[model samples]
Target: MADKEVQNSKKPPSKSVSVVNKTSSVSEDTPKTVPNKGPQVLCLRILNSLNENMKSQKERFEKLESAQYYD
Candidate 1:
């Protein structure tokens, strides 16, 4: 078992591992992002939905406040 452990730790004679240890190789001079027209449309739709929800909430709050006048 000890002999096998030693043999396993050493790389196989013919194999050389090209290890990439860096997070990114891109330079600051390169463009940070590629253009995506799809995500922009999605983001606009999300914003519009959120705005609708906010209006609904505001109307509900006003209704609750009006109901509290008699209490």
Candidate 2:
């Protein structure tokens, strides 16, 4: 009886094992909404501000150079 039990335990699961089926409710036509624009907008704003600051700094340096050349 003990040997029979061990043999049964060694056997693989039957072919009739239940398979879990997963179905997605999302369809292809459904438009995916963006999660957040806060970070993206902040990054763009920071880039624009940096560009403007660089332009101003360049203008100031050029003006200083012209003044020194005239002196």
Using TM-score as the measure, the top candidate is 2
lDDT of 1 by residue, 1-71 (tens): 99998989996679678988875322435443446778876675566666667778999999999999968
Steric collisions counted per model: 0, 0
For model 1, the local distance difference test gives 0.70
Clashing pairs in 2: none
TM-score of each: 0.47, 0.49
Q: Which lDDT tens digits does candidate 2 get at residues 1-71? A: 99999998998877887889995433435433445688876665566666667778999999999999999
Segments in model 2 whose C-alpha atoms lie over 4 Å from true places: 1-36
Residue 3's lDDT within candidate 2 is: 98
